[model samples]
Target: MKSALSAIVLLSLAAPAAAQTPSDWRTPDPENILVVETNKGRIIVEMEPNVAPAHVERYRTLARKGFYDGLEFFRVIEGFMDQTGDPQNNGTGGSDLPDLEAEFPFRRGASVPFVEAAKLPADNAVPQATEVGFVGVVPVRSAPSMQMMISVDGKAPAWGLFCQGVMGAARSNNPNSANSQFFFMRGPYASLDGQYTAWGRVISGQDVVVAIKTGEPVAPPRDVMKSVKVLADIPAAQRPKIQVMDTRGPAFKALIDKARGADGRVDPCAIEIPAKIG
Candidate 1:
């Protein structure tokens, strides 16, 4: 099923060349940024703590401990995803931390910086009709604010979408088993939406994520992440100055408009949020 949509997914994420003034870019919080130096190249990820707080905290704790360095991409599939973060280098190891509960179906309050792309009808899976859009660089499906009026809490439920470049926690059949292993999506896969915890999205290096050598077992000499560090942890002189297109700004609004299809609905995964690293 996924293979059939591979071509379309790739094409949809193709960002048009846009020259933006310096004001269009915004610097991400260093604490929420990750610099993944892989054998292929540097990949920058902007994590959304608001979406999956526990998952984001776990990544930060493990990264600060240097637990992610030297881990290899053990399971990579073309047009799918790249799974890594196993100390055993074969997907059977994790940090000693206890497992975490699933973080999806989070609450999306009115204050969240959500840029709506399209509205979706309610379904069995999501009882409330939802609006799909980008909350910063992360694609999300959220119940409309109207749902908040009668709710016990004042916020509506929302979850991250498994869009291209999204980051998801790898878990066993048990939904809460995610510990240290995670994957970076190579293409959009909606099936994983409520199944795994999505904590962030790659703001840069979608090319390098897809360029990872593809294999279920990824034979010897598999690509490795040489170092994974929180941006704030890197030395001031050594850190790569980074900026992502402001999702709330007109430039990103234009990008969102450009991604809309004939039906005027945007494929959350089809967007390639632009970034710059200096």
Candidate 2:
């Protein structure tokens, strides 16, 4: 009888420990993964075309053509962002390509995968607020699920939250002036959410991003992106196999609950999706 009780206890402990075995993780499409080899270190960004299709295409096109190689991070503001993708190693220059239109407040259909982490209370400014969650690896703020019933289409509005490691395109005062220049956020800045175009988020080497030289215009010895390419463009043998924790899986749901604690709420930016590169 005592032996049976011990076996049951051991099995319970082993179950959660193995919850994230191979099946709970998803491999990002190689074509959608941006590999930026900077002086600081290599950074991996997983592009979400479903949120900003045009922006992702622009990044992939330029990266494949070697347009971003050797571009210096000229405007690196500590605790803010590390800016690069300029040809001249200055804040002013960009690729010869035409500017891109702003991509914000992207609409999402029912088919889009979303795992809600926490719900926000309605305030005076937001009469009918909703929950915050992750759509793949990107943190997002989405409309209430019930909104689908009243909408013309079955889609609802959603936008990516500006969490740490989130990537946003640099633009001039004009809303549509985004070009080659972009920045990797070192910390969360909610003001940029509805304004700038956020195309992706860093999956690895965020430590390298924050370690970058800090200045409004980094002095002569600025860090440079030695090379940039889509992961699929790299030779098969040389490319790293990257996998991220699938938020839809039970393991991630358990993590969300653990993060929420007794309050039953969590800061969206505080949740991190684990990633592994092999």
Candidate 3:
């Protein structure tokens, strides 16, 4: 009986380990990553090739061609985000490339779906849960354009969370106005969803984003991108190598489980592992 009980304990301990799934984690294509250098500091972002292949490719082409070398962060909203990517530095500049069809419905997880609302939701009416077996929305084939932004807040139903250092595409008053000008999420703000197109997320240098000075009473806040360069432009031998956590892996699931309780509220740190980069 003692030996049987010991075997059961051993099996229990091994259950989670056995269930752990190894993922084919690959580095972002050098062409698909951007290194945005701001006066505050630098941010490293990985474009979602799976979600917006055309935009990602176009951005890579533009960056490699020196299109974003000296742009400024023209719009800085305090406690929100810093917007930039205007080649003209006048809040309205873009590449010679024609406007591309919007790509919507990129899957991050079970939380959100990317797409435009053909019809607005009814007042006080919550949409039904999305049906299972839904793959994600895809973009129409058309011309390619380059623009992006970053998020710094919680997740949205139709948009990426405004997490620190996230990158997204800049747009005009119209939803399709995003051309080349973009923004970076400086802080948490959920209201911008459906108002902007989220195209990428920063993988590093979030501390630089936190340190940016907030916009003040007198002038438009400034957290300018000193330079935006594609990793391909840098010599292979000199580029920084980073490994991102696989969001779909068992480790990530364990992390999410540990961060929140049965009720969804995050537990105090005393009972949880420090949620810092491992």
What's the number of clashes in each of the models? 0, 0, 16
Model 3, span 97-118: residue lDDT tens:
8765454433233233332212
What alpha-carbon RMSD in Å does predicted model 3 have with respect to the real structure?
14.8
Candidate 2, residues 91-184, lDDT tens digits: the string is 6677778889888777877887878898877766346687778877777877887788889998788787778888888887777878888888
lDDT by residue for model 1 over 101-196, one digit each (tens)? 888788888778888888887778777678998787888888887887878878888888887888988888777788898899898888888777
For candidate 3, the TM-score is 0.65
Question: What's the C-alpha lDDT at position 227 in model 2?
Answer: 96
lDDT of 2: 0.78
Q: Give the residue spans of candidate 3 off by over 4 A.
A: 1-26, 106-126, 130-159, 213-223, 264-278
Q: Model 1, residue 163: displacement in angstroms?
A: 1.1
How far off is residue 39 in model 2, in Å?
Answer: 1.2
TM-score of each: 0.90, 0.89, 0.65
Off by over 4 Å in 2: 1-19, 124-127
lDDT of each: 0.81, 0.78, 0.48
Ranking by TM-score: 1, 2, 3
Name the regions of candidate 1 deviating beyond 4 angstroms: 1-19, 123-128
